[model samples]
Target chain A: MATATKMRFGIVIFPGSNCETDTWHALNDQMGAPVDYIWHGETDLSGYDCVILPGGFSYGDYLRTGAVARFSPVMGAVMEFADKGGLVLGICNGFQIMLEAGMLPGAMMRNVCQTLVCKYVHLRVETTDGPYTRAMSKGQVLRIPIAHGEGNYYADEAALADLKRNDQIVFRFSTAEGEITPEANPNGSLENIAGICNRERNVLGLMPHPERCSDPILGSADGRLVWESLLQAV
Target chain B: MAKARVTITLKKTIMDAQGQTVEKALHNLGYEGVGNLRIGKYIEMELNGAPATELPAQVDEMCRRLLANPIIEDFHVEIEE
Candidate 1:
């Protein structure tokens, strides 16, 4: 329990990253946890208990959403950290980078409407077994905002099956009452998946911007539970 | 010197929203023959002093590693000396 106070977080900042400050504010100011900014070129990550890949148009989203950013030097260190079971959370563009870096399974495509989808969305918690969701209960509905142009998640049939069997799915887009339907899916993601964890349950990638809604003044504090879960897990 | 051109497209199993939208626009313009339209990326690059024999494999590796994501995209490569 006392170890929770020592849990430090690192947020990676790529050139064009716009959400590092928001994430920093959520973890450090709002939550009173120690956090630092790590440049994309950084290669050492031994000092932090958790690493975050913040959202933004890294490399101007050229070629593909995260193709260029995946090769950043810090990613090697992030991968090493995750391989060793250290916690990592990727939000929006960060989620795309994780998919491009092969840290997460599946890929992101253009939104079904071919336009950026930016709005507060409802996500039904699928599982609370992982570090990121340990403080929540299954079937809990959370209001988080999602902003992205390419967030249509896709996975092959076989990989989808594996994710289902391993319980890697953590959150799914749903109605206010937690009904999973096509209308609830904003980006045409397969199974309306809004978030997922790695097989080890240490790395989490989600399209929603939890940091944006971490304070009640911002409209919702449901995102605070995600931070609390990490603190409690540590 | 060697030059490589790569074309990347969404996998057949994937729905291409951009392609569909463009197709609809073309139909509105009375180009109904433009059916089965699909949008893709074309990347051209030049390799300085690389042996022609190795260009194909090298470019293919690049496509596999960075240019195209196998989960949702397929890539084709062409090299010229």
Candidate 2:
């Protein structure tokens, strides 16, 4: 494993963000990484190398899942951090916030089934070129859990072209056999997209809860690969 | 005082999953021959003291910045004085 210098991870906690503790434990305890929870009201992001917006019903998913949370004070700093090429990862509701804040491209719509889906899913790593996927090999199938009512990813044709052209499409929903098929598309996301990175490759947003699947006893340790990859990338 | 009404809906190119689900339910309930049903959000806000002439632009910015996501949603702002 290529180990970069020790990096401190900061998890942003919105009013209703429920995954901070899980994310905190995953990084601090499981990975032996330094991590802390930062309030949404905080505007200073001077100390952290990587900032993660964990999943949850932020603001009770009011005015749309991540709409209100996009205006949080901490988001301003997060944006600044991102503009300066900081590594930003948004999982689940965090992905919604990233889209709402225009930090990432595209938007998330309600699942095609119109039901809250909570289950483990297989995702094929489309690219290992981003900060988060640096340690993951291309085409690696990872079993990660996703719990959300709105996870259908949508993007316009031009954006889709750009994503592919820039190699920003980092992961696609796939079967355990690594076949990208419609049946494996859990949320009806465009082209079964499960995750994507920004043009700069410093910001990544995805619907699955990678942190939740990082422990072997928890059923899958594939999620730890993302954290480990991020560690080395930073 | 002015009231701004924001109407937000999924872009035509995007599928409205919830709307389609509701459409199915409606069909099952015997509401046959129903046209396309699209679900969207209607937001009403009262602006205090902002100039009426500037309301449209301000409202547009609000839609672009918060009320709507341009990627998958289209929004229109109607002002009532």
Candidate 3:
């Protein structure tokens, strides 16, 4: 057996972002290389292979979900990173920001019934072949935390068709029997989508927080595979 | 010189769970007859630096990239000089 070298990951932090440290420790401290925090106001993105957008109420959620975050100074650097074929992951509010920035497909619309949802849920990996899920096998149920006011994912008909055809739909929420259940679908998302990857396979936007599930101390650490998945790529 | 006030709202088909929650809260607070409530966005920006010809495209890009989430929200920009 050989020791795999740790890789570099860049986590983006906006003024209201609250999950940067958690994500940093979950990936860097637990699985991969040390993580670096990229300020939202900074425009230059350099020396990092993976870009992460952490969750928080940006601009007090003044405009909409991620409406105010897409214009952050550091997003230009993130956009450039995506264009150059770099890995990018958006979690919770990060997922909203990605949709707003047009970095990934679809949007994180308001959840169905409009109540703040916070609980542990099961997420099935639809594709483990991608960089973000490579460490896990399909049909694996990960006990992860889901806390958000607006996390429903949506896309137009054509776009949804394309996403399905292109295999960009990465994760789907399911129940104990591995059946897609409307009850398990906490968010009012189409097709019970929990996460997705961009066409390039480098950009992954997921509503649930994998960082929150990286340690057993916090509870179920089924999300360790996600961090494990990224340990290989730089 | 002209600028626009862009207002974006979630599509009617989509459920505004936040608004509904707030509406319920309002009703619970003894406020009645409030038929509906929907939460959206309002943005006002003055673009004076760009040349007149490029302003529209710039605003369009701004709306497409940041101002609105095209999947479930629709936007309208009111221009004035």
Candidate 4:
């Protein structure tokens, strides 16, 4: 831990945010630190080092995941917070909302398989260098769980080229057939993109649930590095 | 009143996982005769452009600012008399 006083971290809890507690536990208890739970309606975001958009259907997945929730009062604060170069992490539905909110680029469409996916997925971290990835090395694969129906990411060629040129491509799906093509793209993400970081390199969003992987008792402990990164960043 | 039809879709290079899944669902439901199920959104709007002169730029700005993300989503607009 970075021995910083007042290590404030807030996780946005929306109406259907089912992973808030798990995220809270992973950050505060499992990781030996504490965080605050902020409602989606709260407008003030003062004195916080990290902010998280936890997983779950915000507004029951209406108007696309995170689309409606993005208009919430707190999101304005989030946008401001992100604009100032603070660390923000979005997972699963959080990731969906991040896309819809235009906090980052690309929108998540429905999954290619058309069914709700719920299982562990292999995510190859691409030289992780953000606040949430400080503890992990680049090209390391982490087995994390993913559960969502609209996890496919799409964008224009120019935008994708920007993501590539900027090295903003964070996580990708390793093809089952020993290739890493978009065809190997699980959930139909273009260019096999799984995770991404914003322009300032402060905001991070990933489809996999690192909070769920913090403890080995649940299934795997591959998520510990993500939490550890936060601890190390401060 | 002059109107326009707007179609929004993911770029060709970007994969449409949802459409593919729907296609698979159709096949699983015994509707196997279909192919290439690409999905996009259609929007209809009324415009105030006079003489049909500035309609193109106006609609383009509308889609560019709010309707589409320049990064991944593309849109087509058609003017209707």
Best by the TM-score measure: 1
Q: Which segments of candidate 2 are over 4 A away from where they belong? A: A1-5
lDDT digits (tens) for residues A1-234 of candidate 4: 323434678999989999999998787767766589999999888888889999998989863577678878998999999999888899998988888788888888778777888888777777566777778887777788888888888776788888888888888877433346765566777777889998678888888898998888989888988877877777
The TM-score values for the models, in the order shown, are 0.98, 0.95, 0.85, 0.79
Q: What DockQ would you assign to candidate 4?
A: 0.42
Higher-ranked by TM-score: 1 or 3: 1
Report model 3's TM-score to 2 decimal places: 0.85
User: Considering every candidate listed, which one attains the maximal lDDT?
Assistant: 1
lDDT of 2 by residue, A112-222 (tens): 878899999999999988778878889989999999999999888888999999999999999999999999998889999988899999999999998998888999988
Model 1, TM vs. native? 0.98
Worst 10 residues of 1 chain B by lDDT: B48-57
Counting only residues 3 or more apart in sequence or on different chains, how many pairs clash (N, Cα, C under 3 Å) in candidate 4? 6
lDDT of 1 by residue, A1-234 (tens): 122377999999998899999999999888889999999999999989999999999999998998999999999999999999999999999999999999989999999988999999999999999889999999999999999999999998998999999999999999999999999999999999999999999999999999999989999999998999999987
- Candidate-wise lDDT, in order: 0.93, 0.90, 0.82, 0.82
Candidate 3: CAPRI quality band: medium
TM-score ranking from best candidate downward: 1, 2, 3, 4
Residue A209 miss distance in model 1 (angstroms): 0.7
The 10 consecutive residues of candidate 3 chain A with the worst lDDT sum are A1-10
Clashes in model 4: which pairs?
A: A28-A33, A112-B17, A127-A138, A155-B72, A156-B71, A156-B72
Interface RMSD of each: 0.6, 0.9, 2.2, 3.1
